[model samples]
Target: AEEARQTTQFEPLPKSLFQPLPPFEDLPRPLSPSGASALIDEAKQAVIDTGSPVLDTEAEPGFAVMRGLALHKLLQMLPGIAEAERRDAAARYLKRAGAQWPETERDKALASVATILADSHFDQLFASNSRAEVAVMGRLEVKGKLRSISGKIDRLAVTSGKVSIVDYKTNRPAPATLADVPPAYVLQLALYRALLQPLYPEHEVSAALLFTEAPRLIELPPAVMDNALARLTGA
Candidate 1:
């Protein structure tokens, strides 16, 4: 009856039950902006130490990282302050950060913030009912493959019964279309959507990328996301 049906629904797959689980090491956890940058540098150094064929590490802590961090701080303060106050705060932070930036790069970093603030898309997204630096975690089962997924969403917008996941990027020349988005970014958004959809079954879930450099939002299409999931789990 109801009990037997429930048991069948929750039964583990035979292959999964027999398969060896992954090692109990520290999972690949998301890090803060600065921490992520440092980790990249460390990883590059490790590759260099091993004398592996790795790309040059000449762009560590590049302008994109600096601009993204400054913009993140501005967005965090925007919700709590008036338009004028928000502008003042952004200016102050950029000035402080630029003081430490190299003379050749200081002006470019500060200018990027002004450009972002001026973008209509940037203003609209932040003005929405959103939470910053939100953490998401869930177990995803795709095509019989089960895996644990966790990451910190840059922004989560909840309006009425619709949910939007927003991730910030600092690509110099922002992607012009959904197809232009990096594969890793597309997969990340797909994973976020999967993790969130079940929790808000009644709400429609969607995701987009906000490229800080170009200051625009690119909505991810459902079909593209499905493909990403298929590739992710080799379904």
Candidate 2:
């Protein structure tokens, strides 16, 4: 419990892609009891059925969790990258990935997720005005009820005043440029953006895909955000 509390207090911060990014040295960790490092290591790296280590620097637990956070952030900011076209692209990429890059997919995903955790720009873009609140948010009306939106928005500042929806992507680059993005990711972000606009009612929204697998952050056009949100009106 103490460890968990410490984890909450020292939230993960992202590193910048430009220039030489700073290493995250300030994030705090609870110091374990004397001589407990061995036990902690055992707990962190327990083997799993999927043939993957639980907590690995090579495939760090922080990596996957950050990927999820990146997705949540993108959903709040730029979700267009994950809309129908992108989702379709993601699917096709995944298939091609399985055929041509199957052996490295897992490693690639780990790299993607890791970049998300260390994304300095990501942390800055999503940082809230309220210092007390680690989990910042906004809302939009979906149908009737006030819907909660804005979860870990990595590039909220980057929209340059456009409403952007974004999804976290772990897929690697492809010869087909669009296929580099995973489509289901876009769909997921689109739903979140559609939910937000009506609830917030003030902000002009847009969408994107923050590729954790690579350093690229891809934006989706406003038209895609509008069309996707329109489709959700009946639902």
Candidate 3:
């Protein structure tokens, strides 16, 4: 038995090692936002549900879809650009984004692009801060109910010692009024304020939601914001 065991151990391993490695090249790449959202019956269902305690990683993909659309619109509105040139630029961006989207979602994203451009409020704000210090992907960490909270600020603009935190929304038929805005969104901006206040002591920081679809800018009320901060910090 010892002699037999020694002979088996010395034998060359079988050619079928680990049942052959998977054909990695044949595997599909991770799905894009459009592709993933298409898998759901309703695109809205793809929106990250914030009810879970864990931070919403899935939110970025949908936000990316909206960001692409917002960029296209912002490009068209750049000052001093010829109307034809602006439209062409916006069209190119839309085409690139649409290529990866399902036909249904592509149509919706395209339609929403014009909505932002049509909003007087968005235009006024963008024009006013054309030279403001803009920060994208602003990151912050804060205490939360169950654990620490971390999030990315969509846009941060500081002008003349006044800091404005803007959160963009891509929801269809964006909230018509401040009251229509979601509590979660309001809480998010408040938390951003809490995190940024110490870093910019001299600047007066404020938070607002820029509903890209409705193109409305709704500032958070002082009372509501104070309450959110109190709850977040347990102060």
Candidate 4:
């Protein structure tokens, strides 16, 4: 029996690892525009699987994410360059940024950006009146408590005493209408509008989602934004 017996020892995990998790309110985490929208959706039990990372700068982003980044970078730099030279500049930047991308992928990004530049309807977006990567930070009341939120607007345009907040979306098969738009996206723009509105109080503040893949722009109506704000702050 002694010869056949096998001795085994068990190791306990660290006590810290075994400790019960704290209440939701006790664990503090920074909220980004996407995270805030996710939280709002979770509260309403309307969450969907968008599969979007919290930040574009995440380590080891997938091919699609990398493509999106390349497109955003191109958009940011293109506005500063004269329209005639944007294509060449875009080609050079994409060649460097997407060195490993398939030739087709590189060509697609170039074409999409080219479409955006050629669309006269978007003239204001690339005009001198607009700015890219506008940083916004402020405290807003949420669920009867003040919470600090910060986000960078992809594009901010001031024209005719009106402010337009533009966020670029690389999602394919873009929403055909406001109703088809994701609630998280709407929430994101609402938060941006709330933060920027005070800074340009005298001007009418508007927001839109620019789907780069389709080169389509969808402006968010005031009523839609108001509804989203109500859901966000529990007003």
Candidate 5:
């Protein structure tokens, strides 16, 4: 019995069989517009990590964050309401949603919403043909990797001549020039343009950032969008 046992040669299992499986790259990567923006520009993530004042300077960020969200909600719902009723409706909505907020903050948000609704520059955006909270989904090639991105456009306007994508911003002092705009914002708008162009091939697709704080609309130029796309795809 001892000789039989000694003669039995036992081979070890292959290490490859025990190795961890490679990352699953085939699955679609779910990324929001903001997330894709940050992924494309590492600096954006760095700025977030550092809490750059350009983003926020709140002693208590929770209030600021919630305030922004409340404003966004108002913007989303305001377009559906009659323009004449928007001001009173906005006041009521904010009063309910912002009961815990300081009176000043609530009033400020109400004023901002009123200003955005009344801005003649954004008249086309709130037109009958426009849609708010538009869901967009598409696959984009990012530096040799394919990724799926999905996000909701704050507002999308479809006209006979053009398809407009508008993203609202609440920055206290919005970017004054194209050069001053954040890289992430540019990337976000550019990606939206790419995703929506195929849907409206006959019409020109345009994107812009509407700063609600001061009610300014800054349209991104074709050259700027093209450059951002080139950088994102590593072309």
Candidate 6:
């Protein structure tokens, strides 16, 4: 007769090095003085060297979000899967799933940030926010370039003869004075304005920030916008 069937059930494995870290870092160091653009350029070079496709248009946000979430998931289970496999599965699994992942923390953070938009509510709000409201959530595209760099515009409104360029801030609002606001925020909008300048030759390129987070308007004048463009172009 067949031996009595033996029964076994899976149990949680003993704790190992497979745990995850806190989602967000607690006040980690800031980006270097040179800023992120230099690092971006370096990455672009590496991609070119590896024959990666140049970004001609923005991909669907979901594609980005899923890729991000998968990475986070992989990081957590990598050790366990890795120990049973290569013992260095983080690098290999990342490659097998998708090669050429970004090495910098900023790019990873950006990927994670895209996850926020994956929320259907946020997506709906974003879509509704873009509708005729014209306060940002629109005007993001290659903006008429062969190989386009992505840009998130602040806002678009028809004011008399002018079409306003606007940006929103979830952080502390910048001061009305150019000197008072953070240089990066000013530059951020300035870059968008510059890229958009050729398209809107008629309207003056203006940059303003809505301090939704600060619950105030820290408006930067058009002159400040000009200064920002000047600095960007090294003019």
Q: Model 5: runs farther than 4 Å from truth?
A: 1-28, 41-55
Q: Which stretches of candidate 1 lie over 4 Å from their true place?
A: 1-63, 102-124, 142-145
TM-score list, all predictions? 0.68, 0.36, 0.54, 0.81, 0.81, 0.37
Off by over 4 Å in 4: 1-30, 41-49, 53-61
lDDT of 6 by residue, 142-234 (tens): 213122234545345444445455554433222445465566666556556656667667876555654332223455676776665454343
Cα lDDT listed for each candidate? 0.65, 0.43, 0.55, 0.82, 0.79, 0.42
lDDT tens readout by residue for model 3, 1-235: 9999998889777889859687775533332211221222223443332431112234455545555454534533543355446555555665775565555554555555555544565554455454332433223222332323345555666678877777666555567888776665666677667667888899998888776544567899767877755544445
lDDT for predicted candidate 3 compared with the true structure: 0.55
Q: State the lDDT of candidate 2 residue by residue for 61-177, as single tens digits.
A: 655445344334333433234333544444444444334434455345434434554567655434442121122344544445444444443344424344544444443232134
Error of 5 at 12 (Å): 42
Write the candidate numbers in order of decreasing lDDT. 4, 5, 1, 3, 2, 6
**Model 2 lDDT on a 0 to 1 scale:** 0.43
Q: Clashing residue pairs in candidate 1, if any?
A: none
Model 3 bad stretches (over 4 Å) = 1-84, 100-120, 123-150
What residue runs in model 6 are displaced by over 4 Å at the alpha carbon? 1-148, 172-178
Which of candidates 1 and 4 is the stronger one according to lDDT?
4
Summarize candidate 4's per-residue lDDT along 1-235 as a digit string, tens digits: 5534532344556799988998767523435675576556544585553656222332345777888888888899898988889999999998999999888878989999999988899888878989999888888888787788878999999988799999998876666888888888888899999998888889999999998878789999988998888887888
Name the weakest run of 10 consecutive residues (lDDT summed) in model 6: 47-56
RMSD in angstroms between candidate 6 and the native structure over all alpha carbons: 24.4
Clashes of 1: 0
Off by over 4 Å in 2: 1-126, 129-165, 173-180, 230-235
Q: Give the winner by TM-score: 4 or 6.
A: 4
Least accurate stretch of 10 residues (summed lDDT) in model 5? Answer: 46-55
